[model samples]
Target: MTIRLTVNRERWWNHVVGVADEVDGLIPVVKGNGYGFGRAGLAIAASKLSPLLAVGTVHEIVGLPDEVTPVVLTPTWRPPDTTEPVLTVGSNDHIAALRGWQGRVIVKLSSGMQRYGGNIDLVAAAQRAGLRTVGVAIHPPLAGTDDDHRQQIVDHLPDIDPSLDVWVSHLFPSTYESLPDSHRYKLRLGTYLWHGDREALHLEADVIDTREVRPGDRAGYHLTEVPGAGTLVMIGAGTANGVAPLSDGRSPFHHRRQRMALLESPHMHTSMGFVPAGDPCPRPGDWVDLQRPLIHTAVDELRWI
Candidate 1:
């Protein structure tokens, strides 16, 4: 039983390089399962583009190569276990927590997202506390247009110290370019950087078992009667593998380019899908495409073709 992510190596690399060329000071975000490529793999990939990388938390700062410098995106109340990665401080309390510590820190300014950040004064507070202030981070909300995101960053620039580099998220290249060129700006990108070329990545799960079922025959965990006469195909991905029903209650499994129906909710390591009698039914050794967002799915194997 296997779940795989097959990459069109040439196209994927080309896209990565192109994005790097297009965006100046690109800091690839290698956090949260590395946007489906796993954190370690992405850290190495990020090193090729830029020396800096961003992780969600200090806990995710492990196993990275020496060439890559990690910047923690989330502000923490306690000191990080290591001093190599740059920390983010959003509040005076966050700054106070690092008192007497000699490490670099980024001041997170509050944006429309209102997720994590403090007033622009936190930058001076951090500097007063004798911490090495590296940059200012602005994470825009996803609810607005690119112009809205750009405006949010622009709103804070006059107050932020001109010497500090500004790290921003969720802005297009054109929007990024529109920012005042007097200050250095680094674009912290994840989804747009890795998954931009959707056609270059493919996700699939292997069919592990198959059984012909008749209508009204009991099946699945609840032992509910089979909905129709079809082939019950067991796939190798389940909740343990990050395979779950979509928010809309639609099945994520597909065979022969057609969506397959789930016999029941996914189990720990497998999901039972149904294919009507006239439809294309996969055999035990066949592979089926999964219509899941790569960010949310975990695969057992990665194949770069």
Candidate 2:
């Protein structure tokens, strides 16, 4: 028994292709648990759209298909020996480390977001250091109106070399389209590209064991008392599988049977959920419906449908 992510292949593929077609220069960000589909899965999907695939670290570059060129979004701690990625340079230290480094680099400029980037002078420093410049990267916040942040990019535009392109992340479709033609923009997208439609995906956990319990019975790792008489179900997902408690005390219950049950804290590779005495009790090996953010899921546990 195991927890798995089930993706509606047909619908999800349609959306992936649609987004690629709409965004002329799309560089799909396939990093960090691969956005719930694993790095290889999204990398394969991104290859169908463009030759460029964006990754968060250099370690993730190995499994990707050879046809795709990896653009590492994070600064490299040490010079990687295997692949020459389109690197990200956000500071003078990043530029200094690239003294003898070869290959293209993107100068990360600061937007109002205030994370992972530096002033526009870093671009000139990188050029002075003799590193090949591909373009500039900007990660903008999506909260409220993005106009002020978009304006920030415009203000920094003069700092960038006219020949270089611009790569931006977390921009709304409207903001992406609103950029002036004077600048070439490539959208580095992850959630918006892969998990755009939540309806296209679902997750389920198989029931591994079940035990009948009465009210006041202790249950789970913490041995908390059961509120009422019901069946104690051992599910196949836990903290190891990236199942976490919701911040607002909400449950990711999608099935009608799950609605009548109380989900308890998950263990390493299993979880305990209590179904009320009147509700249908799941048998061993039965699949229980569940949902969680794709970003929190482990890659190997996914089973694409």
Question: How many pairs in model 1 have backbone atoms within 3 A of each other, for residues 3 or more apart or on separate chains, i.e. clashes?
Answer: 0
Q: Mind sharing the TM-score for model 1?
A: 0.97
TM-scores, one per candidate: 0.97, 0.93
Error of 1 at 89 (Å): 0.9
**lDDT of model 2 at residue 20?**
82
lDDT of 2 by residue, 73-142 (tens): 9997576774367888888898898877777899998877777789878878888898888899988777
**Residue runs of model 2 more than 4 Å from their true location after superposition:** 146-149, 257-263, 299-301
Per-residue lDDT of candidate 1, residues 170-236 (tens digit): 9988789889977899999899999999999999999999999998898889997788898899999
Q: Cα RMSDs of all predictions? A: 1.2, 2.0
RMSD of 1: 1.2
lDDT of the candidates, in the order given: 0.90, 0.80
